[model samples]
Target: MAWVVAGVVCVLYFAGTARPGYLLVRDFVTVPDPVLGAAALGRDGAAPRAVPLDAITAVLDPVVPAALQQRLLLVGSVLLLGAGVGMLVRSRGWPAVVTATVVATWNPYVVERLLLGQAPTLLGVAALPWLVIACRPGPYRSQLARALLAALPAALTPFGSVLAVATLALVTTATSGARRAAAVALPSLILCVPWVVPALAGAPTRSAAQGADAFAARQDSGLGLVGSVLTWGGIWAPGAHLSSRAEVVPMLAALALVLVVAASAILAVRGGGRRAAALVLAWSVPPVLVLALATPVGLSVMEVLQQVPGLALFRDTHRLLGVSVVGGAVLAGLLVARTTRSLSPPAVTAAVALIVSVVVTTVPDGPRRLHAAYTPVAFPSEWADAVSSVPAESRHVLVLPWQAIRPPLPGGRVPFLDPVPRALEPPTVTSRDLVVRRADGPVLVPEGEPEIRLDDPTQARRALDSRQIDVVWWWGVPESEPPPGFVTVHDGSQITVWRRGGDPRSQLPRGILRPSTD
Candidate 1:
């Protein structure tokens, strides 16, 4: 029966895989800076500042489409979820409860993230509960196989690696004589050794520096740290005020339920059980404390701490959703065991209600569309296609400001320069400008902030000459006036491409025009 339920869930996930492109367009469109950075690293050893836009373009690159990979990821997540359910059904007591908790924690919201190619954090969160279940001192003799199974997911991604280590350390400390925990943790340690090679081979990239800065920035504000926790925990709704009376009711009810179950569990299992409870508290404490110290008062303590340096290593605080659910499951299971022993029908009914309530509250709404705040930036299909239409031999194509390219070009070999806010570099640019002055390639002049400064023809010409830029893609033009010395070749509702001078190709190098088909 348990396997049947797991099978149904897996099928639902698999059935949803057919429209990976549409899914990417709808829900996973927001090209985060980190994802952009990762893509750039995958393309070229160094990432680019102007690569965020280019990365999106690269994902759509005709040569290397991400559709198949996305589908496989969806399939894998479904299988993982089924595996989690199977583990729960086969286990007993706290271990069974832990497995169930992991299933609940791998919620639709988290699954949605996974479906969208953001596997690092999801992988990390998934590893923790799995490790706990695998390392629990039990009668299982397949120690080697269990250890490998526990470590494999964690070792696959950066986020998972951190979470695997943290869980291993915490579980070992909490579980007396759980010496085999070290064996389970060995795989992750072994897997992470290679990242060091990259650090050794080149000068440190801004990733480390930026990561540090991002962490420190959170520490300094404390608001983000707090808000991050609340948001991550799924406790704070997008538009609702935390202090409102409406919010207080749900918060209080959830808290009351959690406390009641926890107390009941402790009372049912005195002695060793009490010790186990203490260990649970201890295991849960550090993350909470780190969150509290990192976040300010009035913030959702759990969410904010997720952004801290050490904590930030684990991207999703909602992963703790597994912890909460697992804790509740353990409490419920213990309560059931105790109540059944006493043969109290009324108590049993109440316990069933409590279990149902926990499940109801925790099952987050299934994956939804990307937030409005991120929609425009998320869907870049039209823009990517437009950019790809540029003739390959054309060296200098000016990209207009409004048409922001996303997912920088694959391999970071192609150069894309946007002229936006001078203070801000494009999210995907390498330390050096490889394409800016290339004799054979066309320089891309991104329209907008910096180009707005080009309102003065002399200044614009000087700006153009300085960067060796020849062509301009102008967007959002009025009929009355347009920039001087440029002939409009293409004009649309919000964009216009311009060729500067009759001999626009004079400065462009031969064979430089290779339109990006991604």
Candidate 2:
């Protein structure tokens, strides 16, 4: 029956991945830099400075095809998950049950990543539990084997390293024996050494700054806790726009069952299963604690605690769903093991039905809507017809703030600039860079707000003219048009293009227009 359940889950996951509706369009369109970093590595060896470079140079390089890479990643995650489940089933009945519970309630971010092609995180998450299981007290040889298996996933990515360390610490406390603890801890520590060099070299500082800013934003905004819980726990509120209440009821019910299981685990700990109870507590508590600490003052800590850690990672908090799922699976397995000792067919059937109900209700709606809201906006698809209408080799073309274009003429290698300047700040750099690098030519300043502010238009114009910018793609007619001698060439759908005549550098501020040799 457990095998059947696992099989069903795998099938559903695969089906979900294949569905067109399941592809998260918005996330793909608004690819964050970290995600881009991974994608760039997967596609090409080097990181790209701009979207055009990424799309043309990185994506088109000799790296593995996108579809193939995605499939491999998906398969790898499932396999790791299955290995964890297998270890749980093979362990003592209580431990098996606890492990299963943790896996079943996996983070929604895992699913989102599957939908978005961010496979490294998924692989890492799936591997953490297996590592824990392998590190449990056992023969020295077996412990070493488990430790190795556990380290494999953690070693693959930076995010995985953090999760792996946290899981290792919990598992060490949960299991008995010095050797087992050392076996697990040592390998993880060793595997994490590489990250230290990068961290010391400056990665951590940048990461910390980005994380702090993101944390501040989350604190100010109420921390998106409710949304994270719904997305991961598969529950939906009555008035929430993303999902139907009916669709969410089952998940809420599953969550209730999980709570019941958690209670049982607590009771079991009191009776004798101290290790199992502690493991469950560790799995559930730290994420919540981290979130609380990150929250800004004023919101009651008590109120914040109730909200969950969904806000910390935004849509990615769906990752916490994994912890809950694993907890539930463990609890279910424990119950089955305990009840089967004396139960008859009818009672067993009833028990199974109850567990199934819990599982069904807890599983969130698949990643379709989540994906739609966040996928990258494809330039070729969104603006192809409009771009096609323009004559090839035309040096200048106006593009809307929302419109996207591919670089080069009819797809040549000419340097293209977005008419409107893109927002180049962190937390979502790829999408911004993509917009900037796909212009028809260098002078095509983007048609909207420049991410950087200059003291005056004279400075802005001077900076542009200095860069040899010959054309301005204004999305909407600016409150004040570009200074005299710039001719408007095209205008439509919130976009206008202007050709420059006299150099504006002379009118610009020396501080702003003078290129720094540095």
Per-candidate RMSD vs. true structure? 11.4, 11.1
Q: Candidate 1, overall lDDT?
A: 0.39
lDDT tens per residue, model 1, 1-518: 33454455545434544433322321122222112333233232332222232344344445444444434444454445445534543444333333344344333334434433344344445455566666666543564456457766555454455556766655654663445566555544764443433323333222231222222212111224442332223221121112221243334443454454556556744646544674346325433644644344413443344333233333233344434433444444444444545546676556555654544343232222212111222223334433333333343444433233223332221112232111112221112211111123333322112211333335444645554444454434434333454555655554455555554222221221222211
Judged by lDDT, which candidate is best?
A: 2
Q: Write the per-residue lDDT of candidate 2 for residues 10-125, one digit (tens) a residue.
A: 55556434532111221122211112232232221111112221232224334653334434555567556655654565554433443353345333434444443445556766
lDDT of the candidates, in the order given: 0.39, 0.42
Could you estimate the TM-score for every candidate? 0.53, 0.56
